[model samples]
Target: MKILVTGCAGFIGFHLSKHLLEENNNVIGVDNINNYYDPNLKEKRLNILKKNKKFKFYKFDICNEDKIIKVFKKRIDCVIHLAAQAGVRYSLENPDAYFQSNLKGFYNILINSKRFKIKHLIFASTSSVYGNQKVMPIDEKSDITNPIQFYAATKTSNELMASSFSQLYQMKISALRFFTVYGPWGRPDMALFKFTNNILRKKQIDIYNFGKHKRDFTYIDDCVNAIKLIIHAKKKRKKFEVFNIANGKSEKLEKYIKIIERELKLKAKKKYLPLQKGDIQTTSANINKIKKFVKYKPSVNIETGIKKFIEWYKFYYYKNGK
Candidate 1:
């Protein structure tokens, strides 16, 4: 399959692109490589992908309609749209970035996918859209009307837009609502990376929501595998659907930190802090809907996931002398 993957340098994008390439698929990857966290990390991921002969890359933002249209000119079998301004707290500081990238950029991808007559358009949404629902283990039918964070609001908007496009133009689209994903080459802004880095450096790691928050922390490999399965799953007769690509288990923030400490074999200086704005108390996914659709089941546990991440973190940082 010839697949076009946006944000190929991103944490999930990098892993997804690599998986597809390894499966002998022709992949065209695009990313602006913005410095949301560090462009160096993005470059490192891109470099690895570039090593594969079947992989092609473009360093353009998805908001660039002309460039995106040019890429769509190729016979693309599917498009995995993972590019977006992602972060809850960062949304509080810079809402426009979210509007431009998550909203406007997504608009470009949707229209172009239709124009190209792509068979499947798989896009990344977030569990954050659940918006602190009173219910446990959020399903696709959960309330999406109230997104506490602008980041979640934009993602929710993408879901609506994708559904409308699918119904209007008979486009096949799947939105995967990813839970808290972590693993090697993960984003620096994510909690696991931050905690690991601080712990290794013997610095104080901030525990948010007073260390009471619970999260469905999905491993990178598990999340990528779910995506791969969905790409090849029996297509639903419907033009649109959403699935929760998560671990199907929630772990406490306090316990999460302890696991990291144990893996690092070092205690972290913890600083407890109240929940910041746009933070949810808990996020757990009802992945039965996904399982039914694609036979998806998360295989990596948190303990193993953290150990792999720690090994990568130490090797990468120590090699770089950071």
Candidate 2:
């Protein structure tokens, strides 16, 4: 199958593209290579993918409708759209970036899909869309109308746009709401990365909400596996589906920090702080709906996941002098 994967330079997108390429599928990856964090890290990821014969890459912004349409003119089989301006804190600082990438860029992708009559479109959503819902475990049927952050709001808008496109053009679309995704090649803006980086440098790690926040940190391999299973699953016409891609297990922030400390055999100097605005107290995903359609079994527990991440981090930074 020929696949178009946007944000291929990103953490999850890079992993997903590698997985697809390993299956001998032709993959065309696109990314703006914006300096959201570090373009060097993004370039490193792209360099790894470029080594594979099955992978091709394009350096372009998703908001460029003409370029997107030109790419769609090819015989593309499926599209895994993962491009977007991520980071809740960043969204609060720069709301226009979210609008430009998450809204306008999303519309450009949808228009291209409609124009090209693509078979299936799987896009990234977020668990943040659930907001501060009183529910313990969020499901597909849960009301996602109240997003605490602009980032979450943009993600919700993507889902609505995809649904509208599905209804109008009979497109097969799936909006995957990803939980706290953390592992090797993780984003520097993410909590896990920041904490790990701080701990390794013997710096104080900021413990938000007095270390009371909980998150269902899904490992990268499990995320890629779930996506691979969904890609092959049969799709019905005009089916606009949403699924929670998570471990379905919520681990407390302090507990996670302890695990990381234990894994690295180094205690982190902690600075407990109040939770910032647009940050949720907890996030838990109900994956029953996804399990019914595809065998989405998460393999990595938090302990093992953190261990793997630390190993990768040590080798990536220490050995490579990154």
Q: Pick by lDDT: which candidate is best?
A: 1
For 201-320, candidate 2 gives per-residue lDDT tens digits of 899999888889999889999999999988999644337889899998998888999998998889999999998999999999899988878878998999999999999889886576
Provide the overall lDDT of each model, using Cα atoms, as 2-decimal numbers.
Answer: 0.92, 0.91
Residue pairs clashing, model 1: none
Tell me the lDDT of candidate 1: 0.92
TM-score of each: 0.98, 0.98
lDDT of 1 by residue, 42-78 (tens): 9999999999999999999888999999999989999
RMSD of each: 0.8, 1.1
How many steric clashes between backbone atoms does each model show?
0, 0
lDDT of 2: 0.91
Best by TM-score: 1
The 10-residue segment with the lowest total lDDT in model 2:
234-243
TM-score of 2: 0.98
